[model samples]
Target chain A: MTEAVELWLVRHAEARDARPGESDAARALTERGVRGARRLRRALRRLGASFDRLDHSPLLRAVETADVLAPLASATRVNAGLAREPGPEFLSDLASEVARSHVARLALVGHEPWLGQLAFWLVSGWSVREPARQPAWLALEKGGALRLRGEIAPGRMRLEHALDSETVRALARR
Target chain B: MLHLAQRLDELRAHAAIARVGADSRGVHRARATAGRIAAWLDLGGWSVLADDVRWLRRGLARARDLDVIVESAELAPDARAWFARERAAEQARVVVLLDDERFAALLAALAELPEPRGKHVRRALERMQRRSLRAGDALERAVEPLDAAHRLRRRLRRLRHALEWLELPAPVLRAAQTELGELHDRAALLGALERSPFERATRAGRDARANELEGRLASFRLRWPALRGELRRD
Candidate 1:
């Protein structure tokens, strides 16, 4: 039996510009990015955000953001799967993982396009067959987070709200 | 095996200086001591204090950065004055951190830490060594190696500290750390020079710093192979 889950899908904060010859994955967060992530953490705490687990991409920026928000989760792990784009199998695996772990709430910190695409899929359904047919309404900015609730299966989840980085920071300041 | 008490004493002493409005050296020492304590805590399996240590370090970060920039980078006189003023403003934030309630709780936790069990020490050192090796491997494959090198530098520091705690010699690790440290400093200087105003006055100095950065990068690339080999042996 699967329990309803609250999934917080987060995009990693603004990354520093890559130096010459640097890999994209090796780029770390800028100082401003760190501050933004910390503010997001504080805002989440203020709103009483809690999660069963925090999973982040293996990439440096996501890992760093995850570290800042780790106090919200009971446990944290580096999920290499998050470093890749989501597909149908990805959602299936996620559903199974959530069921097995009994995770009622989870936070996923990852990169763009991937996170945007995942959020799109969860809110909309597989009815949009081609990737090109998907709407752009779910795009997330750096440091933004989307809160989804309900079943873990794709297309079944409800989009509670999507917050931009600025809003989150403003909320945090309040 | 960490002398938690001694480490805490060092943090307190340096933090006292920092809280009173730190000079550049005081900021450096306070930050370094806090980092050492954090690393020691990691090695000893004191996971509870991780957040506190991270919070403390984050609070000190700006102060440390300004200190390093002032000490290592060549700035136009006007730029130097501007940075000094900014640094002075930042000291107030650092002082506030020292008086924060979380800091007091961190101190109390450090005071109560027990010596790590002997069995855990070897396991912990092995874990740290593995992490360092992974970081070194990432550095080799990195397209932009500077950021990777910086990450490796941090892992290397933790490994060196763990070895020191165990009374083991780590001369190669120490040497590699120093080389990486110089490279990082040069890179920081180049970055600061790039952003500073008074560009016309600072151009020659910036170009010189750029060349220095390239030289250090090349030197580090040459040394990394042998360093990785040493890490593998350990």
Candidate 2:
């Protein structure tokens, strides 16, 4: 039997308005947002959550945040499919691409709808309530790192792991 | 009027001499000076048109040696009509000499008039030359910083492309780290989906793919920070 995949989901910090009447691609991370990302990086290190590969949204804000955290953990790559507005088809494609890679523990830094949906799929097998608007995190632990065949449920995930910047900072320091 | 004609000939001669070894900046300055000279000629009573003049090829043209060409007797009408046609075709005012015998004789007589040594004409020519030199220097200075930025962006892009071709020994571990980073971006998207009408009926599937990538990336980081740094730098 294969071990269950351990997934870590992280949301990007605050960013300035992208453009006056344009898409979110133009947005950039604010100073406070950068600090928050650094804090998260520290927390992941303290938690002993070692990642082998780092993937982030191609959006500038997400990319910048990932760049900050990547030096502390692993090599970072930008994946356009992980963007906030990806559809169901895109998520499925991402899952297949990831499955083929055979990574054990993965961390993704992206936006809202897609991440929330990904979390719901991982926990409930069916999406439950909407994911939190603020930075929310989910950790999944299943047996055998090769396939996600085990009894997957919300119980396997832990909330409040990365709810705020202060807590994340403390975790990093620890 | 005769003095003005001699002065114009001298200015044209000077312009022709300046065109040798001139770059784009130098050419522009020379053309501007020629324009000013043409403007002064218009103020005089000579029916001379400086329109459609090939300022760039001034020194190269054989016609520069000839003072005037006569093809007809109506000097003003023929010269004005040729000037209009040339200007329309070239999109610039060019100089043309009339084809009238009397007018040509008059111009020949004027060309013999003693040239003026006015300081204003000399000063204007010098200023145009100086302006061209400044423009050339400014262009040289602007390239360095712009090149640096362009090189950095290209290096980063190449590194990203190279990663696609790598087949690491521990694929699962690499996949996990990659997924973790991806999850960060996706989570933000999920947060926004709550406000939209395109709600999904089924949650995205729980997969082990992301975890494997993260684990791989972590292991690689521990083993090869130096390579990663090199990749980022280049």
Candidate 3:
């Protein structure tokens, strides 16, 4: 059976471009991205996001972002499968991880393209009939996060909303 | 599990969905608002009427296999109006079917399954690659009917989809597709030019346009192998 969970997919704050030869995995978040992460934290709290657990990719930027938002959730960990591009298998791993926590909601901090891909997959499979063109590839700007609510299964989740940093900040301020 | 599956089915059948699968996964329901009983399927044909909802079997998911490979039965209707209404007045009561520990196992079980999505993508990619090679041979030979640039463009697009599904790095393939798409557009325009009433009006000037189109086409072809090479990193 499918579980209805509020899954929040967070793209890491901005990171400096990998120095000429620096490995992308080693790069840390930029100061502004750090601010965005902070804003994300405030926003999640304000929105009363009850995340049972939070995890991020091993990459420095994603780890840092998770650290910034750590206050919103009870615990944080480096979830291996969340690190790179989220293939269909990654999703299964994630859903299983959430189920283990036994929480209806969880937060995932990670990189782009993958996050967007997951978001796209969750909203609907690549083939969708729509009023709004379900993202073929969602572009979640730096520090942006998308909320999915409804049944959690392979392709049963629904796109609740996409939040920008300022929106989070404003919501938090409220 | 059985109860939850039944509930999910009821939701999909009675309610309007937000985003469904990216490629082929089926429709999913957004939490609906209060007092908003789907009075009738007002959206359009193939869409259910809210007033008299008759849920289909497709809406029901697998209780045994937690990871559902849900397919949207159809992707033609525009459900924007209904969705917008749902958004405006949603007072949805949220629910979660599986507890945390169980949820975790179900998700992981899906991944560890004999033929998970990743494996499925691999198979799909292999099939697309075989088809691409056949298309490539025809493309290289510039076979008359099959040699059309549009056909090649279509082939590239399918290959791109497979690459995406497989989560493979596809910049080169993307660039190739874009170039082919542009070439297809130019070829189409050139063909249209030849058939237009204007072509007879200026028959003598047409050769210059044709030469330019052919030149671009040849250049695109010359670049195809290099682009194709980038995708073959086996």
Candidate 4:
């Protein structure tokens, strides 16, 4: 078997508040968002974080997030499997893909519902449709990241640690 | 915009405790043990019964890695004592990583995924596929070079990893891996014997080791037709 994989799941940094009819995918990061993302880089280094590869949603905020945290690789990747309204099937496919990514440490920079639903499905194989059986939902704040290490196989991963934005800011203070 | 030096000062004084839990430790060993169990489901099934032993191995390795990390890091006196005790307790205890229920859960959940493998995943899978093909070609040569044969074994092992990831059937690749692995081991043993002091001191020892290696090599060759046939069938 390949080595155990580490997924550093991240939500994109703050973005400009949307304009009326402004496509969410076209929305760029605000100045504050950029600063927050740079801080994220500092925080990752502080935590001794490194990655073999990274992926992001095609949306602008997510792409910029990936650029700031982890520069885009040579290959153009498809969506990170994190839709704004992700469901069980999406998260399941994400895990299935993760299982095959073969990377020792892969960082996925994307959006919320993807990370939240993913957190749920990872800890418990059930999704929101079966919320009665789902475990606690993990909230990954903007500029926050969770370090997960294990099999990407459903219900097999253990959340090694989760750091909220406040916690990360605190950690990055020095 | 920043108070960077002070920030560094605060974090340098203390580190987070590493005693996450039994669940976090031994992930690799646990999954491998589970695989071994799955592989031997219909056989004598000692693999299933040996679950406790696998857990023990996992616990030991996790605790050791934890201790090594803590001992090597700078920490407050209080933190050091806390880690020392945790390490001691960790060293003394063991835990099972997977039960039959979780194993079945993993299989079931993954089986239901709706999408085809993602782009990065598929690229990696195709790379392994190509490598396995090359290995197969190496094995099919008119006079297979030992090095090429060794590569075939490595390629098969890699193909197994990819297949396992894809949840594809891998017994054929695994069987080929086992055969090539044994062949490599015997070849290595012969190399070691050739380098031994006793073998160097006596011509008889040298000749005996050569004969043993030749016998094993011939036996390994005898399996080729069967291996080729197996690969063809798969």
Candidate 5:
């Protein structure tokens, strides 16, 4: 039986420009990205978001963000499967792994497109939810998560928060 | 046995650095050390795997197979491929065995051997130390600027908050507002410089510009706490 799990999906903060000939995996976070991560940590604290585990993409930028936020929550390992471009099969496998492990709440720090797709999968079903022009977040609660088990329609998952860069900047300024 | 001895010697070197106490040392020492090192290597996530015995045999022939192989379930396929290539290209394998006093003595003797080129060795060591010191200094300077920006940002935030809380004289408020805008711009510029490619460049021109910006940022950051404290007092 599948157990309920609260998954907090976070997109990595701003990062340094990718140097030519370097893999995306090697890109490091910028100073602003680091500060943005710290701001996210503080915001999560203020919001009282608690979790049992924290996982991040193996990519340096995502791992750094996860490291910054780990102290605020109880994250055990940084899983690489939660990287950018993780397909539906990978997500299914990950969800199954988490379910088997019985972890109640998990926070994942990853990249764009993938995150939006995962959110879409969780809420809408098969089709990918295109990432908003700006960084945004959706909270999938109740049956909203179950709908992601298969291909479903958009608008099925309730949009909890849609944060743009300006909103994030304002938050960071706070 | 010689190969195993050499591997054990390498393990001993690591143990020395790890400070594994003699009281806990035993036959398992080599295995434990190997296991620890393997774990570290696996965590680095760089390795290649082979499926068939043919490839594995070929890899062993070409690369000196280190006595320990650390494998993780989550290793990426590309990382695994890289590891495979590295193993296939390697010519020697490391063999680790438990501790031996005689082996330790041999390592000590090797260390005592006189340097063939004393002056060159000394100069190289000095250069390495100097480079390390310079890097540390650069890091120290970098933090100063970041801290300054952090403080100014915080102060501006508080002033805005205070403005929201009370009715202030228009001119005084206007002055504070104007100062806040300038501080914000300066903070943004400093942040941009911190992220710029020029910041990472070691060229004299870039270094000079970075140093100047760092100094200014540090000064601002250093004064912020006190400034904020004063504002609180008022």
Candidate 6:
């Protein structure tokens, strides 16, 4: 039997407000965002969590946040697709990427609604097409990250652990 | 303006704490903030402040390097003690740098700089992207691929920083920079370990690690062409 692939979906840290006339992607991380990322890195270290690969969104906030966690991975990549809104294509692309790579452990650093939606899809096979049938949303706060394990399929994965920024801060404190 | 001001305040606060004691995190934050300020200056075309910001960041690099080694590397007690001493020395140097008259001058200048408008950020991104393409061309033509690759890596870093300012998507550039960064870290760590006196066990581990990184670097080099192509389109 093949080893179960572990996927960690991480939301970007808290970003500062976008400057006047600046695009959303231009918003960099705030001081709290930097601290939150570092704390999450420490917390993951405590859990003996290391990634085979880490991919992040192309946005400044996600890139900066992922930079803090780079030491835990052998290599990192930017995934432009990661910045896309949650939908069937996003799910299909992610699933195919995982299946193609066959990475035992992968970490993705991206934005919120997408991260939450991916997690929901993985765990419950939630279909975004049916908005009316949408179950309770699995919301991920800024600086939060969660682990899912099992097959790489849409509904085959299981949520192993979830850590919000605050929880990670507490864990790091210990 | 607010973001810059807030970061400047945070940098000062962290620097003050770092001066009081040998706090690695404080020093790290100060160093990071300095880099961010430099990036902002580039995006804003605040060329006058760029040199000072670069100088500040370089000054903090040594202490940050020592902190990282002390935190991450597995070393014998004797080697650990040696690093601890080196860290103390770096901390002292950091104190002097912070107290320098130039540091005050830089801060005053930074405070007066105007905020970067959207147009400036867009222009910087376009300019940096062009420069990166030239660097890529140089890499292809250079006799020594390794040297050229290193230069390209630095160029890509600046380009990515500019891209970040505009939130422009460049997966190829990001991947290249990330891989290059890891490659640099592994090489530096191996070099540092090799320069130190360690037991046979440590040397063996270092060799194993270096071998692993070397393999990865070779593969990354092989992928560079494809990456460069995608980056050009990006």
Best model number under DockQ: 4
Ranking by lDDT: 1, 6, 4, 3, 5, 2
Superposed on all Cα atoms, the candidates' RMSDs to the truth, in angstroms, are 18.0, 32.8, 24.0, 20.4, 26.0, 22.7
Taking the tens digit of each residue's C-alpha lDDT, what string does model 1 give over A1-174? 367899999999988887899777767889999888888888788778998988777677886788788878887655666777887776787889889988989999998778878877777776324567566667888998989987877778888877887679778988
Whole-structure CA lDDT of model 3: 0.54
Best by TM-score: 1
Residue-level lDDT tens digits of model 2 in B123-185: 533443344333323323445422332232223222222222222133332333344334333
In model 1, pairs of residues that clash are A21-B143, A21-B144, A22-B143, A22-B144, A23-B144
Any runs in candidate 3 off by more than 4 Å, and if so which? A127-137, B1-234
For candidate 6, the per-residue lDDT at A73 reads 82
**Candidate 1 residue lDDT tens string, B1-234:** 448788788888888888877457666787787777767776666434565677788888888777777765456667878777778999889988888755765675456444667776778888888888888878878888899999999999988877777677888899888889888877876676566665677788778878878777777777777888987675
Kindly report the docking quality category of candidate 5: incorrect
Provide chain B TM-scores across all predictions: 0.92, 0.20, 0.45, 0.42, 0.25, 0.81
Whose DockQ is higher: candidate 1's or candidate 6's?
1
Clash count (model 5, backbone only): 15
**With candidate 1 superimposed using the best TM-score fit, by how many Å does residue B177's alpha carbon deviate from the native?**
0.8
C-alpha local distance difference test of each model: 0.78, 0.43, 0.54, 0.56, 0.45, 0.75
DockQ list for all candidates: 0.02, 0.00, 0.01, 0.03, 0.01, 0.01
Q: Local error of candidate 4 at A100, Å?
A: 4.5
* C-alpha RMSD over true interface residues, model 6: 14.7
Tens digits of per-residue lDDT for model 4, B1-234: 122233223222211112233333333334333333322221211111123233323444545444443454333455446555665666334322222222222232222222233564556556656666666666556374567778877666655644554567767778778877666655554443344433444456446655775565556556666765675555
Across B104-218, the per-residue lDDT of candidate 5 in tens digits comes to 3323322222212435434433443344334323434564545444444433333332232233223432333345444444444334334434344324544564566556655
DockQ of 4: 0.03
**Top candidate by lDDT:** 1
Off by over 4 Å in 6: A1-174, B20-22, B117-120, B136-149, B167-172, B199-203
